[model samples]
Target: MTVRIVTDSSCDLSADDIERHRITVVPLTIRFGDREFVDGRDLPAERFYEMMANSDRLPSTAAPAPGAFETAFRELAAGGADAIVCVNLSFALSATGESAQAAARSLTGEVDVRVVDSGKVSAGLGLMVKAAATAAEGGHSATEIETQLAELKDRVLIYGVLDTLENLKKGGRIGAAQALLGSALSIKPCLDLTSGTVQEAGKQRTRGKARAWLAKKATEVGELEHLAVAHGAADDIDSFVAGLGDTPARHPTTVTLIGPVVGTHAGPGVIALAMVPAT
Candidate 1:
């Protein structure tokens, strides 16, 4: 039986990669005021960023409905697939994982469906999905693929520095007190996902300082495997890559654009580093 792999838009995969690997991507919904758009579908990265700039209202994102996963799973199962592995963003960050699990449960004995909570978002989750797809392409069983993904999941690390605290405040992620303090000091707070939710790792006063701080943290963590540098509209790939320098050679690196779903919350000029421990 052919093994099938699926994931949600939060994975941050490129179109070419998705098609090349035969991976199915389910998109989350992005709502801007009264208008709604599907991540990667109606709302492509470039257009989403442009809309974000024009609107004062902060865009809100929602996990794809259970039916969305159900449709994808059913299609694969109908195509004579034996089993499926649906990977999604961290359950703590979005309901995508839960929705996938619910859909899988509905499928019951007909098909073997496994839902993996990546415990990471954006390219961090993308890296895991890609690895799983690679394993599937190698003719690995769904169970084995899931095991590899589970092992890789814990090893993944995401660290981000936002350009401003305004988006956080707009998203209701930060309180007025913290926002005031962060703004006054020009504090570029470094963040990482711990226990699924974004949390403060540390902070620096400027972009250069923050970049250096992130690199230092990456080195301290050690065993870097897959490295990713994602940015919002602003292009800081050169400096970000230069900051890593020799550290990136310890692992493979992929740079991607931070799409609307993540960008809406992170704000512009957001630079994130996703690292996986080397085996």
Candidate 2:
């Protein structure tokens, strides 16, 4: 039986990668005040960040409705796919996983659907989705592919530095005490997603210092199989990668502009590092 892979917009897969792997993507929704746009279709990453900078209202994101997933699944199944593995962003961060599972229940018995909560987001989740697609293309069965992805998912690490605490406060991520403390010292908080929820890992006084800190953390984890640098509109990718020293030599890296769904909460000048351990 032929198997297919599915993921949501939060995976951050590039357009070329999606087409190359024949992977199906369902978009999440983004809200900027009264206006709403589909994550990838209506707002490209570049335009998303541009609108974010100029808009008075901070952008917010929501998972796609179950109908969206249903439509994608039906189309793929019609094309001779006997099974599907739907991977999504962390359940703790969004409802994308729940919606995928609900949509799977409506599929015909000929197509077996399995929903996986990646417990990570952005390129971290992208790494797992890519691995699954590769496995499926190699003729791995649905059960074997799921097992491999689950094991690899735990080894992925993501760390990011937010330019302002204002965005965090606006997103309801911190309390008055933390925000006040951050402001008093000009502290920039470094964040990580361990299981699914974002948590404080450390802090720095400047963007330069934060970039250095993330690079050091990335190296200490282990040998990286895949590494990525994602940034908001205001971040300097060249400086950020250069700070990693020989780390990039050991592992190839890809750089992508952060989209509004992620940038909305992270705000401008956000830089994130995604690393997966070598197998």
Candidate 3:
């Protein structure tokens, strides 16, 4: 059976991976004040960051309508896919997963569409999508892949150091990380997003210290099954990865730019690490 993968723009997977896996990416809407643009389509990351740098208010994101996901599923079914798995951003964070679920319900028996709540965003979500696409390519049944993902989600760990909490504060996504707001001016906030909601991981006086802390945390986790580095237009990404030392993984580590959906909240100069533990 031919299984294809579908995901939203928030996954932050590389273009090559998408093409290689024949994965379909539905886009989310990003609003810069009154002007709205499709994530990654009309509003590329570079352009979004440029506009954000000049704007006084934080941009907002909207989940794609159910029709958008239905269109993607129908197109894939028409292209001869026996089954499709639609992985999406965390259901706890965005309504993207709900939209995909709605679309899947509309398909009924015409085609099989499994909507998975990745419980992650950015490269954390990207890692799961990549694995799903790989499973599809390997001829794994959609049901099997879905079961694998359910187990994989709990093993995924995502941590990041944000340059500022300004975006999180403005976007109202602070969650349990809100306590960091009190000391935002004095320290860089380290966020743990493994739970699909932002929580405080640590605090650092400097960016370098924060990066080191991230690397140390990864080391303490032992060997990794998959590793990915995601950043929001950060220039120090190379150095940040270098500090992580050797990461033993089944696949080569992926370094992806944080797309508009994630970038909207992470803000600029935000760098994060997402990984799965070796089992």
Candidate 4:
């Protein structure tokens, strides 16, 4: 059976990569108080970042409706795709995976639709989607792709340095780590995606120090398979990326913008690095 891959916008795969692999992306919604915009569709990344800078209120994200996934699955099946593997953002962090699963259940025997949760967000999740799409293009079966993703998920590593905790608190996503960044004092919080949720991994007194710590994560991830830098309006992204050393030359690397979904909780001036060990 010819397998196809589907993912949500939180994966943060570039438009070029999506087009090249024929990967379908369902966008999550981002809201600013009373206004709602479809992530990457109604609100362009540039415009979202601009509004975030200008607005006093923090934004929120909503999972895509089940109908969206249903439409995508029916289209792929009609196009001769015998099977589809839908990868999605972490279920622990968002309900996007549940939505995909609901859609898959509705299709039943019409076409094989399997959903897999990467237990990751942004670039980390994007890497798995890209891999699955490439595997599907290479004629791998949906079952095979699913099995590979299961093992691949554990090897992925993601780290971030939040410029402020206002967004996390405002979004109500701040969990145990809220104790560290709950104050208004000037503090740079270093975080990593742990068990599908943002958690405090380290603490730095200043933004520069936090960024340096984030760069060090790449060097620490020995024998890399995929590496990427995720950011949201960080002015020094170039320099921070440079500190990552030559890991980019050794493995496939990308610089992805932290889109609205993750951006809402991460806030502006956030820079993150994700690396996966060779599998």
lDDT of 1 by residue, 1-279 (tens): 589999998788889889998999998899999999989988989898888888888899888889999999999999988999998888876778889999999999989999988888888888888898889989999989989988887788888887777786667554223534445357887787634676777778888888788778678877676778788876676777776767743646778888877787788888887887777
Query: 1-279 in candidate 4: lDDT tens per residue?
Result: 799999999988888999999999989999888999998888988788999998988788999999999999999999999999999998888899999999999999899999998999888899899889988988899999999899888888888889888888878777667767655366788887846887878788888899888877777767787788889988988888777667643565789888888888888889987788765
Tell me, by TM-score, which candidate is best: 3
lDDT of each: 0.82, 0.82, 0.91, 0.86
- The clash count of every prediction, one per candidate, is 2, 0, 0, 0
Give the TM-score of each candidate: 0.92, 0.93, 0.97, 0.96
**Predictions: Cα RMSD each:** 2.4, 2.3, 1.2, 1.4
Better of 2 and 4 by lDDT: 4
Candidate 3 backbone collisions, by pair? none
Better of 1 and 2 by TM-score: 2
Q: Whole-model lDDT, candidate 2? A: 0.82
Candidate 1 or 4, higher lDDT?
A: 4
By summed lDDT, the worst window of 10 consecutive residues in model 4 runs over 243-252
Q: Candidate 1: lDDT of 16?
A: 86
Task: Flag regions of model 2 displaced more than 4 Å.
Answer: 108-110, 173-185, 248-251
User: Model 2, 1-279: lDDT tens per residue?
Assistant: 688999998877789989999999999988989999998898998888788778888878888899999999989889988889999988877888999989998885757998998998888888889999999999998999889988887888888887876666677644323634446348878888656677777878887888788888778876778888888876577877777767633457887777667777778888888888676
Name the runs in model 3 displaced over 4 angstroms. Answer: none
Task: Order candidates by TM-score, high to low.
Answer: 3, 4, 2, 1
TM-score, candidate 3, is: 0.97
Model 1 weakest 10-residue run by lDDT? 175-184
